[model samples]
Target chain A: MVAHETLSRRSVGSDLRAMGAVAGKELTIARRYPSFLIAVLVWPVLLPLAYILGAKALAGPHGGSLPAFEAATGTTDYVGFIVIGTLLWGWLNMTLWDVGFFIRNEQMRGTLESNWLCPVPRGALLIGATLTKLALSLLFLVISIVEFRLLLGVNLLQGNLALTLLIIALIIPSIYGLGIAFASLVIRFKEANAMVFLVRGVFMIFAGMTFPIAVLPGWMQAVAMALPLTYAIAAMRAVVLNGAGLADIRGDLLALVAFGVALPIVGYLAFGHMARRARRHGDLGQY
Target chain B: MTATLSAPSWRSNLRAMTAIARKDFIQYLRYPMNAVFNVLQPLIWLTPVYFLGKTFASPVGNVGFAGYSGTTDYMSFILIGTVLANFITTVFWGMGYSLKTEMDAGVLESNWAAPVPRPVFLVGRTLASITITAAMSVVMLILGAWLFGFHVSGNVLAALGVAVPMLIALYGFGFAFAALVLLMRDANTMIDVSNFLVTLLSGSQFPVTVLPTLVLLVSLALPLTYGFDAVRGLLLGTNTLLPIPVEVLLLIVFMVVMVWVGLVVFRRVERRCRVLGTLNMH
Candidate 1:
């Protein structure tokens, strides 16, 4: 018989391949349906377009839109404020909502049970799916930025570039945690599709995506700030708008760090719990 | 020709309509859990948004530009947006999703095979959804009035008159979506398109004045915009009530046309499905 260490190494190698397979499946699906893939780009594009035109109509004559947007969140120019917000949002959307509900969608297609029988740890499959979603959303962010810069005459200002990147990078796992945590609920509840829109609708109002979460009524603002999207947004705004270093976004940066560590652990426990419960109940195949 | 085609008598058709409606109600009751969950879908939104105006610290005084948009009463503004959009949004995707549900259950085809007039039968299925919308709206409106502190200045009777045909028209537009559901197999895509399009049309994020010209034009083209505009005019005390006549007239015409078209399209699908073996769930 082979030694225990060799067996462990073999399992790890297989797990890596399994994760890649899941990511590959998501990419192929997106490629086949280019329309859906393209629409993700449209959402980010709309965010900037709303700002440029609305600001032009509303802002003081010959005084920059950049300064005004910067005063609110610390960025100058429409591109920085809108792009960073949209990019982090795109990341949050990918990691949390997008990958989380893949199982629910699979259930609807009557494919979940069969997919469950495949040889791989559940964690690998989920992580792989999250990887693919984040990849596509990042692609969306790039296309939208380039398109807006060309069509809307917007440009970005450089400031704390590395910190901005760090803030955005920290946003992923926190969001992935939230997404997986909720996806667990979807697996249990059988209403993930409906819940996705409803939950996202609530998040949009609170996340400072369209308008500042500060615009929310007081108690609601507190709730909004608690979400990972809020932290991601605040941190991005700090770098892009306030010319802030990571030091300036200590609170937001700290939040993201905690989210990165805590949320995934909590999410994994919940996801595994839900999956096991469903399997035991025999409802895993019922959908 | 032996009066064989005596043009479907109204008496029997009316009777069949009631029977079909009764059966649909029974179907709704048979799934009590779904019914409760369905009602909760809109109710869940009433709280988070309607009372969340305190976040803005009593509005920005220039929330939508021209100093006319912001208000100490921004909660009411958001309330109207969420409530009206909640009402209109449900109609489109619900009709479509319900159609998909019916098709999956074989109920759509089974009802299609019945001797009842297709319009009556389809209307019967939609009746539960329509009733649900009406009931949910009343509950939310009462809750909003009480909780969100939004007061309506419109004559209550006048608002009711406006809302009556308006719901019919909105539901009619919803049925148009429902009709197309069979033509497009992916209910999720249909839901996404309608949700996205209606969100643009409703101007929920900002005032309609802030919308780009193209989107503004499309908003006018949609039935929901007229409802939102009319409702806002009454609730917000900004625009005049004289334009209410035009909105009412357009809404009525749209209702008739959509209902007629929905019937026609739905019947065609029923026949198409009958030709294929997929009509039944077996």
Candidate 2:
């Protein structure tokens, strides 16, 4: 019994060390740079500025324009729309661009071969990195929502928002998983930055994060429907804007679950495949 | 990489042009996924049209309005602006900016060290970015027209004629932005500044006439405004909202002057960066 306990304790220690190392590396890189912080704040600041000014300038041609827009938002709070959009996107953009491009950036920095040479499993590395990003994401998420609320008053369409938070929590892992799939492609192609930028732009357009997916062209609408963010954004808008019941958002919840289940397996498989291909090409360190 | 075309026959010259274009295209092919989205960026900007449709749709309450309206079935009109933006942005971001970035990556150094004529080689990359933008714009046109009922009113060719020059002007601005990136060790500010500047100036959401006098004047000075104005005029009619030709001419002049200015400014940055040996470090 004593020997068994000792072995188990040692195993736990190793796991903790691995997780700590992965998180430590990611935090150091992101925190050391001002660009990362700058990138995080850009969208949130710009949108509020643009919308506030435009809303102010337009003035509804009559009554309190801000309130009217707020009412139009279905939440008496105009901010729910912008807040949800900005914060969720803040996570998504950071994950896809920052965390997802890890392999590519590492390759560029000439650390790929060394990183891969370690005994740690790729799964552990990715999870650890993703957790760090998620934490940072949560930090900004709070800052953006709180800051925006303080500065611009929240619309808070409905109360008891825990389930919404839960849905976001479940989806976060899957979203990073999906990003890993994209990262695998990035690792293979050496053009991750361009892809990251393009994805960021498209997110601004079709992800339903910035604007409603219903407004997209039919094809674009179809594409949006297929994306993971569509469900999250739509549910968010529905709950906030429409005071939607769970039944009304059953589809979105189900979709998020589907994404969680399917993406990790497929994305991990893809990552493994890409890692092998990159190794064969000796470009794992090419970054 | 560029090779001088001294081949004197029309067939050969055509081949050279095709080759240059092809080389540019091949570079874009290196990342099909990214290229696809680069063009899609502008189309994505049209999302504000769907919701609050009841309120936003009044921008084009006039059937003949040359201005942008979120409410009109003229989704294609907005798409025109977006497509033009995509074209212009990709040319700069994908072509000029990426080239300078590649130069720092030592790819440019290697290419320069090779015997390729600098202009010809770089132009091929530009052409590639242009191709992606063109395809994206066309896709946006079709998709936007299908969903929102957009049209080109008087003459499609006239719209084309207007758009070509305006697009040229837009690219000129892109080159200038790229030049700044080359010069500024970091021009994220330029991206932010230009991000709102082009969209706002183009009267993308409302007529310039609605802007403050100074704001209206500034919009008139930008080619982006003209791109949108010419688009509105061709498809919707300028008088429907505001004067269209004012924007069209401004864009034309801006494009012409910017092209020459961009070449000069960008080349100077290239020379300075190369000479300083700081071109390769972030």
Candidate 2 ranges with C-alpha deviation above 4 Å: A1-10, A47-79, A103-121, A146-287, B1-22, B29-71, B105-124, B185-197, B205-221, B238-242, B260-264, B267-282
User: In candidate 2, what are the lDDT values of residues B30-94, reduced to their tens digit?
Assistant: 76776566545545545544333322223333232222232234355455666665665656565
In candidate 2, residue B76 scores what lDDT?
A: 50
Q: Evaluate model 1: give its lDDT.
A: 0.63
Alpha carbon deviation, residue B141, candidate 1 (Å) = 2.5
Instruction: Assign candidate 1 its CAPRI class.
Output: incorrect
Worst 10 residues of 2 chain B by lDDT: B62-71
Listed for each candidate, the true contacts retained, as a fraction, are 0.02, 0.12
Q: What lDDT tens digits, residue by residue, belong to model 1 across residues B63-108?
A: 3333334333545555666666656666665567766777777677
Cα lDDT of all candidates, in order?
0.63, 0.63
- lDDT tens readout by residue for model 2, A112-157: 6786676666667777777787788777776676666666676442
Q: List where candidate 1 sits over 4 angstroms from the true fold.
A: A1-9, A29-35, A38-97, A104-119, A143-161, A188-207, A210-226, A271-287, B1-8, B11-73, B171-179, B202-207, B240-242, B253-282
